[model samples]
Target: MLKVLNAGNETLYNNVSFNIKGQEIYANSLILICAAPYFEEIFVESSTNFNQTYNDIEPDSFRVFLRWLYGESLSQAMQNYEKEENRDIFFQICKDLLLASSKFNISTIKELIEYKLVTYIHDDLVYDNLEKVIELANEYELDDLFKYCEGLKDVIKDEADEPENSNIRVTKNNSRPSIINNLKLRFFKFRFFLKTRTEPGHKFKVIN
Candidate 1:
């Protein structure tokens, strides 16, 4: 697959361009169809001759996922995502990646991301972040994390719970800002460079 991507011969015929937030990605329909049923549907359903593109997707997220589809490691795809400045949107980006993975039937990537989400939530367990955790738990249907949150909720219920110990038993999330809530327009932008090489028939061939 990487050979064809590098050689660019196989990508020439019947390719589609995905328009993501003004950035374009040209991919082979057959390969994408074999990998993801959703892509098959997208190609089969298109009624135009200009090729199909999904404008709703985030370009950076798609680029990371597209790199993974070609042979890059998920960890590499997530490396920039783990930066301190991007931490607040990490889970949100993960969630977006998860959605894309699910759409593309990328099980390995999906499972790894799900595990990361669980670990992040676990590490963030506390009263000040309970509601944020709970909201994400519910959004992702994270049963174990929700149970942990419930246990902490019970601590606040019991009058015997110490007021001095706000460690894990911190107050509800309403008192503090949520990471998701604080995510602004800039946080959603996962900027990355896309290498391009011009090919025949006006096709935008991917080089890296």
Candidate 2:
């Protein structure tokens, strides 16, 4: 059986602290090292500081990753976000988690996120979200998912080229844009994440 840790509610044996964008999150070093072995280097016995800071990652996304680290089902966490009726937040979290997983060498989470994202795109071909996914897939070298998104792009092109669908209604979120006749699709700005560890005693820090 998995021993699940209640994130902020846990008091016992929570030795490491992650200060992300002024928010303090506590976790067990053992759990983190077990999930991602490279963390073992960051949480060394010689290191006096137990706090890690990250400006690049969102607190919500870090919490989602921690939940999975502490044995919560990823699907359940995603479902909770989906029930909130704000799918943008849900997808954003997935995107962030995918990046974090890749950085931490957590292949399981990375693969799961890729599958989830592609599945979501398949279900709903939202224009903006699809474009973002395409960028991530291409940048991250996710060849298969990138190819799938390219196919979706062709579908979008076909729909956009249709004169009858030129006046599709635009929503408040602008998720569905006007047909390709007048719509100009632009790629999202690229973001870079950097992690630095200058010395042995210094804790790891992520800078955007």
Candidate 3:
């Protein structure tokens, strides 16, 4: 099982080397080719001489990719970095994974990252966060995610544009009160009229 040969057990099955950030990471050539077609060109059939330096991608992102390639569930693999302290780094890794998956042409990782990013939407969703995700969605051709983020951006924009005094009633001449507020105002007026009516036969007519 690929899971048994993961991480620290590098000496067990590794045949190809990747130099990421001056750190040497090793993996099985067969596994890489089988997992992503991008590696098929790098490692020829049964050839052992393979070493590549990757300067564009972060080491953490590459590690996550390898773990997924080595039979780890994407969710389970991300659990280690899901802490509050690691939240920022984890988000960056997910973003990097999108690029890495794109370069490798791996749809599974891309789909998982899309779903993971979508989970970020909520009542407290931030505009900047949504903006970044939306940009990534468009760049990566994630149409569904792009649409969702675009809609959420509009919703958040509308909410931000709302007046701070939105809950406060406007002047009667300026605007109509909300239904509940109108009903409460009518009840208060009727109560005042009744109170006045009891005073010395006061002629208080309840006007509609």
Candidate 4:
């Protein structure tokens, strides 16, 4: 329907066109009216303006929703395009879709973003953005990702505080003592090592 509608199929009079964030798109009222009650009211009150552009959501993210309405799956494609480049932008748009979905009470879109966020816990989800993502999870009541993020605090801590090296050295002196006696005397010493490297502008304390 989207492909046909986008191709300017004037025969489909049952559908309505929209300029969402300056990008033109449209969908069948029968399909979107039920999913979004706001559309239903717009049609009911005959208040929809075909020329007016709706700026409620971002253009690209709104395109995602329009595609989803046309029977295309969103979450699977997002997971398949997993890349490190522009991670923040992708997640930020996810947040936008989440907000837009929430506004219309579209649980499917909301759930799609939740699943993506849960997957992010294993990827670039780090301490820098942890608080923001956790806030979003809490806002949406995404218990799964919330608990996952909580568990990662410990995991990230372990990653940061891990010992760089731990070695044990052993020495034997036959004149001083037999091998067995030397073993009993505790000649082996354990050493703990840690890396001193830290990123610039990161908080570091020095002792005099």
Candidate 5:
């Protein structure tokens, strides 16, 4: 009852349609209608790393495969679903699809991954995913991916140092004047004077 489209050999289920132009599996309205539930299950299961698994597929072929997998267009596939469950499921699918595309050495997929990383820079969960993305980009020799990851290192480092309750301020007491205390005071005064005299707007003013 379910019609299966095969990219390899350009064939359809029951061998009803055959062509040499290329194997593009087009799901009919009836097939999409009947296959929604099954497709949903497959999408969920394969949503994690499906793209990496099919990395050997050529770009054109993979695009065709994607078209067959999602009855909608690429733009539609990128839309955020309303339902929480659907949104989560779709993102998982997109992640898997990107991984698969990377595996296939697809430049477009690499760019997409970079875009996603830049877009989600503020996400706490992005670091782990970005690590993997960096590894993939390195392995594939994707220059843009490498640059994006390199830039992300600074962002991640800043985040790591930004703790709410970790500030430490030391106070000095003038009650006891030791050599160290005198030196510290002199250094503080020198720094303050330097800051005051180094203003760009008053560069021509002489410091007394």
Candidate 6:
């Protein structure tokens, strides 16, 4: 038998146990759908289903959905999923998560989106995702993301204008001393040179 509890401060699953497919499982919420052998048990604060259609049915999709419902961070949602060799699903999940996060008022998830998009600025593929990133940043008033995009724009323009085989090097040039100091040093050097050049026969007394 499956037992469920509503939102409350008490720990519902403490020492309470059940059997799923002959394996002992203890959780807060258990949804045992008819004709389904596996049990879906999850511990969450709140959950709701939207009428939106999903193209790909990946775990990340469900994770993002949960994040949107609970206002959880992107990092927390990603932690719930197991790591996969191909991250295509993960990337799409991140994009969807950002959209959902922005739709709601999830500040931490929005921050994660900004961090990821800003890091992509140094990549050549950033141009492909530039529009979406810029739109999100602008909508959320992300100053750092906007600045990073501006810097990437300048870099792309510079690279386009520069010729191949042209090595651009940056060097620091030291400037001379002030004109007044230079004149003072020159006068002092001239006086020293004149005194040293003159012999004892033509003795000259130095005056300040």
User: TM-score, each model?
Assistant: 0.57, 0.72, 0.71, 0.64, 0.37, 0.41
Per-residue accuracy of model 1 over 45-124 as CA lDDT, tens digit each: 66353354555557777866665666566666668877546756776667677667656655455445544554454444
Clashing pairs for model 4 are: none
Choose the strongest candidate by lDDT: 3
Better of 1 and 2 by TM-score: 2
lDDT of 4 by residue, 112-177 (tens): 565566555444435656677789989988775576667655544644464531221112222323
| lDDT for 80 (candidate 1) | 85
Angstrom error at residue 40, model 4: 1.6
Clash number for model 4?
0
Best by TM-score: 2
Model 6: how far residue 36 lies from native, Å: 30
lDDT of 4: 0.55
lDDT of 5 by residue, 1-208 (tens): 2224434324343222222134433333334223234333343555542222323333443443344233433333354532334544434444555655554333344444344333332232245655765775576666754665666555445544657313312123223234225334444454354345333221111112
lDDT of 2 at 73: 65
Which of the two candidates, 3 or 6, achieves a greater TM-score against the reference?
3
Q: Model 4 — TM-score against the truth? A: 0.64
Candidates' lDDT values, in order? 0.53, 0.63, 0.64, 0.55, 0.40, 0.41
Candidate 2 C-alpha lDDT tens digits along 12-64: 67788889789998888877776667687788754766788988888888887
Model 6 weakest lDDT span, ten residues long: 33-42
Single out the weakest 10-residue window by summed lDDT for candidate 2. Answer: 186-195
Candidate 6: C-alpha lDDT: 0.41
Question: How many angstroms is residue 23 displaced in model 1 relative to the true structure, after the best TM-score fit?
Answer: 2.0
Deviation from truth (RMSD, Å), model 3 = 21.3
Q: Candidate 6's residue-wise lDDT over 157-198, tens digit each?
A: 554466741342211121323322433343345335434543
Candidate ordering by lDDT (highest first): 3, 2, 4, 1, 6, 5
